[model samples]
Target: MDISTVEDALVTDAKAHLIQPWPTSGQIGAEARSGLMDGDGIYVTDMEGRRLIDGPAGMWCTNVGHRCEPIARTLYDQAMALSYSSPWYTMSEPSVRLSKRLAGHAPGDLEHVFYTTGGSSAVETALRFMQFSNNVTGRAEKKLIIARQGAYHGSTYLSASLNGRPRDHDWMDSASDLVVKLTCPNPFRRPSDMTEPEFCDFLIGELRDVIETRGAENIGAFVAEPIMASGGVIVPPQAYLKRMRALCQENDILFIADEVVTAFGRLGHVFASKEVFDIEPDIITFAKGVTSGYFPLGGAMISSKLLERLRSSNHSDAMFAHGLTYSSHPIGCAVALTNLDLLEQGLLAHAQEIAPYFQSQLKTLEDLPLVGEVRGLGLMACVECVADRKSNNPLALDLEVGKRIDAHCQRLGLLVRPLIHMCVMSPPLTITRPQIDDLVSILRQGIKLTMDELVREGLWRG
Candidate 1:
């Protein structure tokens, strides 16, 4: 049978059996879907054998690239040795070693580790820990979580409630009263008249107001991503994180740094909280690139200070009571250990060297009329489409500008993530300068193609 015939069969089976996440039913089989067959380095091959450069790195997780032999071998060897162990009572060698290694790399005196299955679980664990700590210390009312608009924490019941993205909570029911939201510190989305410094001050002042009104004793934690990845790669001002940390310190609120996307070399570091952002978070939640998308593994790093307090406090006898069956899976830990080695060996340095070039090249897209903004930090970036450059008004949602760009980019031998009216890119850290050039060229053409289509449809003028 021809490859085309095989691809058709697979797509048919997928349409019937697969239920995709975050899309309407009509979008399922509306377009020709590419079934990824394999990945090598920065490229992935579809069922039809088309090799395309992976732009978003499998949801911003594949930092060390694809089909890494060491990672694969580690997974295989660990499975052969010990696949699973009940994390409730028993412990595994790999898990212990990984915890020690991660704690060493983590910021501050965060010396304790609680393993989870993935990013959501890591976040869930952190929030649960905060609640438990508060309850044990006789501060049951201090359970309110403070999350920011445009933040993506996770999808679990408690963690999802902390999500501030509109679409994430529009249809879904959340523990709303339990989570209070602060303004998203997106400089690009800030009011036009406000200067960057003024915008920062405004956001900081708003947090202070929330603390004063809501009462800092009532708030449990303030969760934030150093660079808001899923929220169109919104990078805040340099001093924003430091200032927030101070506020948390002053209020006795636990500061949870959701470094799921920024950690493990995506930002050219093992952990970005202290190394890049210069903040000491009480708890740090991490996942995604921890295993470089090779295995499902995530964890929370607890500060020694907090743990000591919890131990010395009356809640020392209170059971925290939270554990996933796969919390400390040996196979996942083995793969993550190897993944960390790969990052430290060379990929981290490579990412640090090439990130500025990547950001600069993507920024060049701003010259295009359809591009309202091109913003990024390190390997992550986003191109926000706009109907009017002067007003920076976003293009109509019905236009599906990001999807249009994705289609053109796919045709041009590249893959990008479409987030509403924006296209996000965070390719494998191992991507070369030449590959970045190719990626940018395709994006340029894709934007042009999208613009032409919108103009032809009378939906936009460019």
Candidate 2:
């Protein structure tokens, strides 16, 4: 690296390469980091000399932990053997094998793979595939994607548009019209505070209303996360997805599962739908844990029915009409293969068995008056903060409650994502009991310090 003018916290000129949904206040946090990464056992060290526990698993990926030698060696060897080999004109062994391997673990008959460079691109592929399948199967009228509110799909224009998250489209004057946004099966913010089944019915009713308004013939597919992540780690109502599956089947619409945040053992299942949730999707989207963030690889796993339509299509020359240059890149596929082996070797089960212990440790936070709710599955979890114990009114984001908590955690050698009033954690799967304990202890101390700072600033009184 070259010499540059350095600021107190973040780089003055060098910009962070990642998109921030909620950027930290004026250069004092994750925004500031040098390019150097030194020795790491569980946590990594940036050149700036801050050692963070990496609670969010590097944005809920990296399930295998940092610096796994197997993944590194495999990627290096694959690169030396062959890296890019014209995926459009020809397929390599790594790509083919990875597809087969992915198909084996995917739910239902999702036996075919269409690769992409990352998760959002995978969502783009799915939407295009849905439209293509509809047209190929003689249903050109079906062109709408029924999406749920507060759901997150991806950042690409079409993918974000298809996602019903309001914040994603705040600045856009003309909203995307192709998506028919519907209420999600969320228990926390239910319209009537009804039962879970009733919630499903209400959500389904919204979908039906959209179909009626747009005409059932105009709906192409319904896309959702098996268990919502990012929006909130919501384990769907037991019967929610199964009923939604039936709804899609009856309507002759495609079912797409956005498993970017939930797949690859995050939910204690190789396939969240097959092992944990038990609902089959016609198509599934995957990323994050595919290679455990060792390499960027994402894709769509489609059912046999879609494959048949592709084979029997009237236009062979028409193409599936979408692809990415890095689709099934050899190095990425090789790393993913190695990472999957780790998961299969029982890491996922270990995380599952230990989740209760982590949950038990976190239960102590309930006594904290600032804490609202604690929820998650597997190794991922969240703690929501509210102003009053009886009322669920979240402390506003600008008040910097999340920021104060995060900064305090950083000072205490922990890193976490502060989402609105929530302080979330997704520690690596290899994290031990003691590490979990340290994580909670640091978090508790961080909360106390943050509250003190706030009280001192006259934002609140003790």
Candidate 3:
């Protein structure tokens, strides 16, 4: 069969049998989506033969770009040597070596690592550890987790409960009783009457109020992402994370930094908690870019101070009793080690140097009448669309504004991740200045096209 025929067959099969993530009720199992055939560096080619820039970097995970030779070779070599090992009885050398390397890069007292299959499991493991630690230390009642609005932790029960994004928990049941949520620190979405500093102060004050109302003794952990990635790249105000960390410290609550989207050179660092955000978290959960999306590997780095305290506690003999069968898979660890090498060899510095240019170029999109704001940090950014500049209301234009823009951008040689009224761009670190120019140019045209459509349809006037 020809390539087009094969692509059609694949799509038919998927529509018949596959149920994708976040499927709507109208097309839960029968959704027909785009068919991507191949990827190289910062671009992917669809089955239709259109080469498009990978704006979301494969769900913000492909840090070193697609088809990396070193990571590919490591996968093969490690599989040939030792493909898998049961974490229950045997531990692999790759796991041990990678753990040491990661520990060296992690900040402060985060000296130990617990491996998992992916981000959800990694976050689940961290929450379970927090619960286990409290149980063992005779503080079982302190099990309520603190999460913020617009945050995305994971899909597991405990972790999903911590997710505060819209529609995350609408159709699904969660451990709602075990979680306390705070306001999202998005400056753009803050009340019109408040200043940025005042908004920051309000967020901190709200957290303090929650702690006082619920009693800090009942709070087990405060989980957050330095910049809420899936929530439209919401970068909190300056000093926000540091202040939150201090509050967690004062209250004896564990601060969990979910860096699944930010770690491994996405933000020009191995870890962003200390180096970029100036905060040391008690537990750091990461997965996406650990192997640059080449292998399924995620882990939670634990604070040495917390571990030492647990070791000295009276219930030290109590077992945590949590382990995944593929926790330390040899192939995943080996690929991750090689991926780290690539990042350290200069990709990290490259991301740091090019980040300013990326942000500045994307910021130019705010000149469009439909664009309400252009905001992000590092290599990640979002172009939020609104009906009018004064009102800054995206709902007036409808949530599908992002989808319309994405459709236009895809036609113009780009793939954008549409999140309601926002289009997120987190291209691979290997993207050059020229590639960025192309991306921004295509995006501007796309938005302009979308604006024209809206105006013609009488949905918007600008």
Candidate 4:
């Protein structure tokens, strides 16, 4: 059959069986698919049947991969015992135990677990809770939230409003009133010659400027990822978050850490905040790795001080009055607990130790001419593409370089995320060394192929 016929057959097969996204075929393959496909144990199998090592574990969520008897057994037993329960009134053992376990790992007084269906909802909950707490404490004017310019918190209406992505504004217009976005701390594209200390000073100054202009009188909190994700894996210069926290304190603004992409063993610690830059945010949002992507679950770990103030209720306020029917889902919580046990047992350490290996693999990507910068810590990394590395001019908008590399990877049997012109690495933490090495090899090959294609297409010249 011709290529389009074969492609149509594949598409038809998917369409016949899958309910699809509005634009996408429902699955996340691109207008073009990334080159690599995942197979069992760090290898992804593509449509053509080639198996490639999955370097960044499935969107950086799979701390435990493929098949693990322990995790599966936990799911099975939990499902059999009781898969469904309303956490609002009656509760399940797994749900109760999961909350305590999460609290145990959380820092400072961030001890209460409020569940959600996923990360976006978790973020919305964190933001809403902060606003509610502020209102309860007689600070009704504190409603404005400070978000980072390029962070991806969530995609819900309010959550999307708070997103810092420029594309977000282009896609939806009515979201500006809810969030005030600050600049991202990327040392490359928006290079700041400032030392780590100076960088923090600069960002804090910017935030301070915002508070000054907008008046913290109307701001509720400032939320950011411990490490920026989706918008490009931008690891902050040291002391940025701490300084931000101090700034928030100075302005009486709540500091929130959006840990959706950095949580679990992705950064080698239980949470990214704990792994590096030990700043304690008043609210922390998490999802993705909580159950290693086995079950849908997300939550916020609210500090004791904040919850205490919010829960007191000046007479009657209706228990914060926000939640979904599946707020504290039983099966989701159960799976998360089992995942937590596995994490505590040893996966976290293994994931952390593999960072050096991941780093080593990533180091190879720097050789590509189009690559302007490569940055990451732990399993998550980003390789930014630019026309001029010196000027750090990103490949012209609409150049579609990230998707190109992703498509190449998919063709080669690998999958990856390309946010802007930066290709991110967030392979499953459970990936083996051999698998990681294979992924690196494929990445190198994919880069070479994509660069050659780009140069030929006149997008780049060497």
Candidate 5:
């Protein structure tokens, strides 16, 4: 197994062998690949040895930053002790202990844990549990899932079907009939005639109508992210989540909160379902920050009441018949356990304290002509670019504005996650106020450079 030191050879080999997720083969071949060689707190060094601030926190995970020795040590020690186990029938000490800790941190009576490989698997597990419960209780028709239009559940077949972002299902197939999509509750994108309260009312009314028209008996669950993450950090009205929760309860619909990107201190809390959003979901799916990108791990927390009901009902003998081979992997659980410890020690509090500063600095970007809106909560924020400031009309898709801004940002010593025309930022919770300032400064320059290019290309009149 000889590794290539030559840059061209490395790039060629990668192009030949690696099928990167979420990108086309032509895109990969056309782009120059830069390998990340190392990382420290809040920064990663590329193959060229250029250290840049990690802006998207490695896909909104890395809450505790990179090169965490304790997390690494825990992984190594666990692998040396007991690396793998058949989660189907066997169990490991690390998995058991981690489950107990997660239960303790989870909201309400969500005490039971079903581990998985990552966020997708966690969501899949939750959905399957809903289906299984329905089947066992003789309500097999209650299998429909409701997800919001900007929601990003996961990439697995069932979970991906719940994803409502544009182009998410472009070339892919989804079980669309099984999933229903509601309007994205983005206050920034609400109708012009509606006030905030009126918009919230309209959304709630729409949801109620959908349930009534579709028949709540046919719906098993309504899944949502407290704050839409990968879908441009779309935040709903303050009372939106609570109202939705109440509706679910009234209609016997299971509320599933997808907290993959929100949990573990991204919102300055272990779990934001109840703590930050004031709603207790019957099932909550979490991943990413669980192990702070040190290892792959995720799980679904089940409300104790649901589990008890399933046990006492005739479903007691029915097998859930769903699980990943990597479920409850010792190494992942060990890494997550240590990551939790790090967060509890101080990282969570630090995130809570610095979030205001992060949001405030990014909000200042709205002053830029190309920026349509700057919105976010806690450490997550997005800068939406537009062609016209007054009308908030988006730029042409061919402009690839987000990618252009990201390129400039990379050249200026920062890495950002670009989604279409939106630039997303979810830096590590361990980042300092000074780091926040640096991030905003780079973003400002990047946006300005993009504006200059647009003007030079005669694409914009500004």
Candidate 6:
């Protein structure tokens, strides 16, 4: 290998060879994203050697922070011991150990685990298991999945179909008929005439109406993220999740809580569905922070009651017929176990302690005229820029406002996750109070700079 040539042409080669996720048509295979060279704690050094606060925490996965020694050591040690294991034929000790640990942390009767490669695979597994269970129990017609607007499940075909973001389906194909999308529960975007409580009522009534019209027997599951992450961190109204869970129970619709971004210490807990919202779901899909982005690992923690029902069914011999080659990779499982250890050993408590400070400091940004609203829960938050404060409309402004803010923030030593006109912040759980102050300060300056730029360009009047 020509080391010098590769090193000199890294960005050029990436432009020529890489197909980055969510690429635009104009630069699908040629976009050169910001190159990160190194990471330590909640900070990452860019290719230019500028250290920046990891504002989005590596897409909301680096819970315990970057370069965590125990997780890194576990990855190396596990690979040295036993790198691969055929999950179908034999399971590794780490996988079994991780399963027991996860089951212990999981809420209610969610005592069984089905490992997957990542969030998409976890969601796909849960849906497939739902279908498989329905088929075995003699209800083949029960296959519809209920999702919500502004929700993001995953990238796999079936999982992607459940994504409610319009752009996700703009140019791509999906099994749209198999999924039903309800209205987004963002109070900021709710109808102008409806109060917050009324908005909540409307959402619940809509779900009830859908169940009645579509028939609960035909609906297999209702999947939701406790707090919508990728959809600009849209946290629903109070008691919304619990009420939805109750509805799912009454209608016999399996509740699949997609905790891909909310689990594993993100919300200061191993799982957020029960602790944060006081509802125990029938199935919970998790990934991301489980291994703190050190290794790709995810799984669906299924209810034991559901498993028992399937076991007692007449066609119990039928197979689920789904799995991944890396279903229970020894290295991934080992890494997850160590990552959990870090969380259990006070990292989770630290997150709980610092989240309030993080949120309050970010809330101060609302004083900026360009900020439409600041909303989120726990360590995840979104700063939405609107065209006008009174109307709170983002459509009238430049759609690339987020990107502009991100460009300014990066120059000021912070990397933001720009989502259209919104900027999402989910720094690593390992971040301290001073680090949170720095993050908010950088973000505030970034927005102010963006506002000035817009004014100079005749884009806005600040």
TM per candidate: 0.97, 0.91, 0.99, 0.91, 0.97, 0.98
Clash pairs, model 2 backbone: 10-32
Off by over 4 Å in 4: 1-10, 13-39, 191-197, 397-399
lDDT of 2 by residue, 417-459 (tens): 8766778888888888998999999999998887777678777
lDDT of 5: 0.92
Q: Per-residue alpha-carbon lDDT of model 1 for 111-205, expressed as tens digits? A: 89999989999999999999998888889999989999999999999989988878888789989999989999999888989999999999899
What lDDT is obtained when candidate 2 is compared to the true structure? 0.79
Task: State the C-alpha lDDT per candidate.
Answer: 0.91, 0.79, 0.93, 0.78, 0.92, 0.93
Give Cα distance to truth, residue 158, candidate 5, Å: 0.3
- Return the top candidate by TM-score: 3
Note each model's CA RMSD in angstroms: 1.5, 3.2, 0.9, 3.3, 1.9, 1.7
lDDT by residue (344-451, candidate 6, tens digit) is 999999989999998899999999999999998899999999988889888345558999999999999999999989999999998998899899999999999999
> Which candidate, 1 or 4, has the higher lDDT?
1
TM-score, model 3 to reference? 0.99
What TM-score does structure 1 among the candidates reach?
A: 0.97
Candidate 5 residue spans exceeding 4 A from truth: 1-5, 25-32
- Please give the range of 10 consecutive residues that has the lowest summed lDDT in model 1: 24-33
Question: Of the pair 2 and 3, which is ahead by TM-score?
Answer: 3
| lDDT winner between candidates 3 and 4 | 3
Q: lDDT score, residue 368, model 3? A: 91
